[model samples]
Target: MSDRNGNPQDPDNGPESPHRLIEARLQKMAELGESVELYPYGFDRSHTSEQMRADEKSLTEAETKVRYPGRIMAKRGTGKTLFVPVQDERGTVQAYFRKDDLGDEAFHRVQKLMDIGDWVGVEGKLFRTRTGELSIHVEDFTFLSKAIRPLPEKYHDMSLENRCRRRYLDLAMNQESRERFRRRSEIIAEIRAFFAEEEFLEVETPVLQSLYGGATARPFKTHHNALDMTLYLRIADELYLKRLIVGGLEKVYEIAKDFRNEGMDRTHNPEFTMLECYAAYWDYHDMMDLMERLMRRLARGISADGKLKYGEVELDFSQPFGRIRFMDALQDKTGRDLMAADDEEVAAVAREHGITLKKGMGRDKILDELFSELVEPGLVQPTFVMDHPKELSPLAKAHRETEGLVERFEMFVAGFELSNSFSELNDPREQRERFVAQKALLEAGDEEAQQLDEDFLQAMEQGMPPTGGMGIGIDRLVMLLVDSNNIRDVLLFPHMRPEQS
Candidate 1:
């Protein structure tokens, strides 16, 4: 077989020959007793490479003994001494392996057994190299695990499709990918801490449901053979979490994995993380405050002055985010008052703006299409677009002052919707009416319409609090904080198409 460039495709004969390397590693393993037990489950790593570097001066003076386990990143200086770079999760440290220091048997073992990408634990004394680089001078070493396949030469610069498909290699070879995931964890931890500090109870909601109702998105469906019933992977956790609120768990939040049978894009994924929080007795206005504080806290956790760069723009999270009424923003951008316009007028405007209108799209859908095309791109700075039309928000409460708008807001930054908040509609009758309207749209070929879940309405009838609810796209939030352009850059294992044979 040949590659696209007409190069030989056989792994055993190709450059950096993965098949040949794997065979050699297997042989080496056989020589060293070769079972799963050869690779021990745990190693006592006294300090991380990062910690050793931080305490370099003190440790070097004290001649402190340390045990560190890491993947061998690079090896140099073959004969008398070996200078190897070993990387753990935190950072990388250079290891100096001298024949005189390790004596003959151990030095020969290190040379014969170790390879780049192999996992090893080294017992060493902390010191600094002549060039002032923090290093560990090894006294002895233990082989932990072996890597059979060769890593890509320029893995960091590999194509995005390959990076997403082989994320383990991407994480191993690219430091940026490793650090981005690290920051993702830290960001989520800070978010949980912020909610906990605010007296919110962290809760879990079911990922599989008998009926899906919460967001307007197509759901991934499955069947349970035992129950002999069809089920849908949750498109959102809003309905279930609100049920918890009805069951008297006030101020509840869930960080959940939401699945949508949707198209993939820079921002959209089939499976994604969502942070949904509902606070009792609060309104959309209060949600706005909470969203701002949460974003600011995340910025402060990752940056110094509550400011961070997303692509070319420097987002300032310290100051209050800007706000624009949804209809006003639409009017300002497209020079059309969509709220006041009839369906035909809105359709005309959409056509004039070169926005493609799907079949059976209503006035609200047309207006939203226009807003996404014209208004959303200009909202680079943190801005809240509030008071959406009633048709655009089925679950949100009707606006207190506006005639035909709902108390709903979507936070946008860098041309992407980061968070959505609603003054939840607790009236069972009103919610039922909204669901009926949604059912009409669904029957009219809109697959992304919310389904009427009777149980949820029963819960509402039993009485749900006047709640303020918010759903933040956690992946997008991580992207903004980490300056990642693609959502997959932040997601550890984003969905990808199957490889063609």
Candidate 2:
């Protein structure tokens, strides 16, 4: 069988194949009138070697007489006897083959037809090798599928750039990637259970909204052929979850896909999952308490002591998270009081910090850029950076004492923003004014600005109760739980540019 690039005889290049050779080989087999194998074939044993390793007791020969199915990863030796490494979803196990046992015709067929990467089901007796390595002694085997291309050799050192580019092969060879995803599934289950225990009803919302009003990010737009109208993929589920609150649902949440038309990075993706929930009659502080508790619970599920080793530091999620005001962080880091700084004074501060500001740029934009550059990276531990500038937060309630600030708190962990919470503004008049301000920003050429959602305003006009709401970055959380350094590692199928044909 040939590899993707047509040189099937070449083993070193097999792992990087795009299945071109494999597909071509299958077509050739069809022309040769060779029938493909079927699955759900009878098997006495289904336990994989990896599963067996995790089991409490040892498996006996009588138990090993069962059948196991998996893909053949490697083959060694030749002629009468051979050793093969077979991998299933759970793990890999060694299989021993003898020429005498199969007889001459069967042995010839095995030598000619069987190739690495082929899916095979084997019925075997269980035994330990002379070296005490657990193995399956094959009595009969069936071709589950023929694989033309060989897999990459794991012994050689290759660049990670190549591994990421050909992730399917990487997944085939790497155990760590598989384990991380297993942990990711566990993390999601634990969080889902936590929300269910809290009596929060998980709900779904429209992904395509008429007006993409939620967070301050650019949105991917699409056109419907039937109606010939523009629609946008949601940037956040914030507005929909809050609408559920207005519908008299006390607590509502949604963990679903959100699309943002933004730049890709190690920490950013054009499309990602956003977990948003809202509870009536609760404030930002209450949300903070619940948020931290939930995080600690998730951490406990992922780690032995409710703590994780990130880099050289151990981040303990067991204790109460610290709270600091936005202005306080700015003053501490930059030695300038953001509350007292006027336009001219803030402009000078920005200039000193090498920040350029446009004409008519407000205090909020200046302060935000400054904080993101200086203050955000240093917040390694879990911290609630609260009371943000009013211009930056249109949906949050006004700060109790600060005139131009809002009651919002963003939780940062491991130098990444994990969650954003706020006491939602419910007054119809105030909501209308906020939307107008956002509309003005959009008109002024801020494409990232939010559009005015009249329908959402009408929902508020129905006298919606004051509420607490939050948006958590599920990918970032999974990254922390799985100890994954890059965002792409946690994602099953990360976005990638199409390789040149």
**Top TM-score hit:** 1
Error of 2 at 495 (Å): 1.4
Runs in model 2 with CA error above 4 Å? Answer: 1-45, 55-58, 61-63, 157-166
Give one digit per residue, the lDDT tens place, for model 1 in 89-161. 8788888999999887777666766778888888889887888767889987878887766667742487777
Question: lDDT of all the models against the reference?
Answer: 0.87, 0.81
Backbone clash count for every predicted candidate, in the order shown: 0, 3
Candidate 2 structure quality by residue, lDDT tens digits, 73-192: 877866687777778776887778888898875565455557787777777777777877666777887767666665777697445655666677777777777778778888877888
What's the residue-level lDDT of 387 in candidate 2?
Answer: 95
The local lDDT score (0 to 100) that residue 270 gets in candidate 2 is 79
Model 2, position 473, has a per-residue lDDT of 91
lDDT, candidate 1, at 3: 30
